[model samples]
Target: MKPGRNMRLAGLMRKEYLQVLRDPSSIAIAFVLPVVLLLIFGYGVSLDATNIRIALVIEQPDNIARNFAGSFDQSPYFAPRSFSSIQEAETALRRAEVDGIVWLRSDFGSGYLQNTSPPIGLIVNGVDANTARLVEGYVQGIWFTWLEQQMELAGKKMTSPVQLEQRIWYNPAVRSTDFLIPGILAVIMTLIGALLTALVIAREWERGTMEALLVTRISAPEILLGKLIPYFFLGMGGLGLSLVMAQFLFHVPMRGSLWLLLASSALFLWVALGMGFFISTVFRSQFVAALVAMVSTFLPAFILSGFIFDIRSMPVIIQGLTYLIAARYYVTILQTLFLVGDVWSVVWPNAATLALMGFFFHGVVYHKTKKNLQ
Candidate 1:
């Protein structure tokens, strides 16, 4: 407001920047942490299951059975290991050597031309039900495809009640990393913005610098702004590093306008910073502030934000609780920006929510911050 307050704010920001430069941990948090996280999560984690080991048991080894078995070998999803008997395949399954077994009975070739359905058996290990379902689906896909091929070769049409055509949008390749990296970026921003500022006031108090600031003529609003401004840039710096890695290193497509992504990111970062500022002001101990920051911001961002798990798939109560997490909105914005582009329908609502949250948290911080240091 006044020129004197402006001068005080400017000086406070400058002091904060200098303090950050002097603190090696600040630099590490803002830059090194992003690099390390991106590298670890980008390369080390994946949801796709490939090269699944499966057992193939051909009862008669007929030309038809051999041709069908060849399809499993050609598929990228499966690595077929031939088993002479169903007993042997069962043993392999018990040993966890193969995920599934496909058995083509002796009557398979005859049944192909007959009125009866072919005698094909599929046995899948149910220890991991998800993987078992995937394996069973893969087996059915191969079966239907082979049946269609046989019908086509014999100049007979296969009858179907309905035909289905699938269209996969956003990520057609279905690489889980493409879906995961943007959400990880949102989590990273929460850590950078919240964790960095969470220690600011507490550290100042621990060092007796807060008393020195309290003695000054600077207002509470000015003090909070001064404390936030520098770390805001530092968090943005971390966001930039994460974006670069996502683009060049991970090759995650950025379909949205860069400006829109940055604008939404800025709003979200402000919300995250406000959360940290509130935590720092409430708890005067640096250790306590850091712990609270991680528990309140980081945990919510990681779990409730739908970073890895689908929020809708969560329990109804847990899904309702997610509305309180700022990162949930930011994660939606990040996924929309990175995968679906500048879809205002998605971005506008979430960005508005973030803006509202930012104002609310900062308002509380300003109200709670007193020059007397109570």
Candidate 2:
């Protein structure tokens, strides 16, 4: 730990950088991975549960039963299939073909609408808490809202008339796919790729491969970049998976330009990859690297990235910190791209922020890595 040891370490570190640059796997991951991740993230990771399968069982084909079933069909969330009896609907629900089942008894037409106990019952699978809540909320909002409006339309003079005209702005259809696809991209990509990089790199260090390369003739930046290349591609692969799921599987519309989406992703991944690499350099142990990456990237990307919650609603200091998080800008550009379309005015600012932040992290990583690797 004296001057001689420090100088000798610095000399060896320069050589390690060169060997890493020559590694092909690293280069492909760095250059091409970002675009793939944007695609996956844009399409794969969606919050909105679409076409949730529902079986509607009605004993009698009354106007009211038909009307009630009609309302559910009009909703994007429910793909309502009619059945003659409750047993049929229950079978579908149990067999996992349907997420929920609605049963309408023979007397649903007259008795149910007259403030009597509902002849219709909604039975849902409670295994996935999030999907279950979404199904329940959709049924409540869509079916009950229609019922409330019907009562008012009948000209009944009732006290405390509730006039709930709920309008969803930005995403007019209230589609979860629009919001969730972009948000989950920030989360899943980070988890599957960015978070993985630090551990993988730290493992190399712990196992002495990094030291073997250190005796060669590469520069510090080359070594850092080399480490980043493979992980960067891995992250993009995750992104590609998500995009296929979002656009093809879920059928969410692509309103924005794909070019813009790729552009934003490039900048965001740069920052994320840099952050992960820097973490690996700092924490040589795989365990600590994993923990730091999870705490630093995964949790924030999921929660504070505006994936699950609104950043504006958070405390002022927290909101300020979100600016430093790569996921924040990624969320912004991706959301605007997905929901608002190719809005350059809306997208550019976030893109610029990501570029700037990426550079900042790049500088931090270069400095830390050069010292640590040396």
Candidate 3:
């Protein structure tokens, strides 16, 4: 009986493998999709604010205005384009030629030396709120530094009681790519695991193969296991390729054990695959399954998984909804392992959650498959 079961399982797995090989779309999802996503997310997307373009308008051309404009020019953060009139600067701003406008009023030459707030106007394009905020902070920093320099040149003492020293942990240089690539890996895995498996059972039903398989001696467990084993390896292959691209192509570091990373990734992939299988089992239409998988997996993974946005800053209801996303836990695991190493305090709970989710999804798939078989 054991030998017969093993032979049947092997035959089923072989059939699944042949099917995967025949389908170009499946191969693309398993292999080409990861590389494409890595390139798009790694190179095309960025959070670091630098080289902000600003139009500098000096209403009255004077030493004070020139000096302030000089200060902005000297700073690496600002690429200043000087304008003779506020109207001209506004034109540039309207055209999106500059990210912000710095206007020095006509009274700036006299008022600036009086130790009062200078008649300087800052107009920022607030279309991208984050970039505008960054530009505002940088402009303020520049203004303060220029004020200190002017005080020193005039032989006046400038002192502040408190000095702020910032230390960033995990990522010292704070490169966004380092923080992003790991999360990208999670997203890539979610796509491969969920999207591909979503098409599996649906394709079988559409092609009239599920009924034929049911007429055979194959048990529900054997059918499900056959579907999973091949795709599990495919998912792992995609994971491995993504890791290599992250390290070699994008220069992302991995501080944790490779084995531990693989283990956690396997757990996450299991849950993702189970989700796909469950979706496929419930909705036998390939189109419906694919659409549902993308909506339920990809969109949530990108948004609610803390990949680009902070969960703490979101609305309370949205924050609570994130708990249901499997990618959230996997993303946390990936970021910790890649940036902070194997911190069991972080890894254990997330891994357990993924394992539990995997079990729950696969159990549903099993029950559904059994019902369909009967």
In model 1, what is the error at residue 311, expressed in angstroms?
Answer: 1.3
Please provide the root mean square deviation of candidate 3 (C-alpha atoms, Å): 2.2
**Candidate ordering by TM-score (highest first):** 1, 3, 2
**Each model's TM-score?**
0.93, 0.61, 0.93
Model 3 stretches with alpha carbons more than 4 Å out: 60-64, 74-76, 106-117, 147-157, 371-374
> Residue 178 of model 3: what lDDT?
94
lDDT of each: 0.90, 0.73, 0.91
lDDT per residue as tens, model 3, 269-339: 99999999988888889999999998999999999999989999999999999999999999999999999
lDDT of 2 by residue, 1-374 (tens): 56754554555444344544665544444334444545565556566788999888888888878887889888877888988888878888888999998887788887866768665688999989889998888888887667766778887644456765677767887766667767776766666556666766887899998777666655566566555655555566656666777787656667888877776776677778777777887888988998999899888887888886888889999999887778887887788888778888878788888778778777887767553345
The residue-level lDDT of candidate 1 at 362 comes to 92
Candidates by lDDT, descending order = 3, 1, 2
Backbone atom clashes (below 3 Å) for every candidate: 0, 23, 0
lDDT of 1 by residue, 38-94 (tens): 888899888776788999999989888899999998899999999999999999999
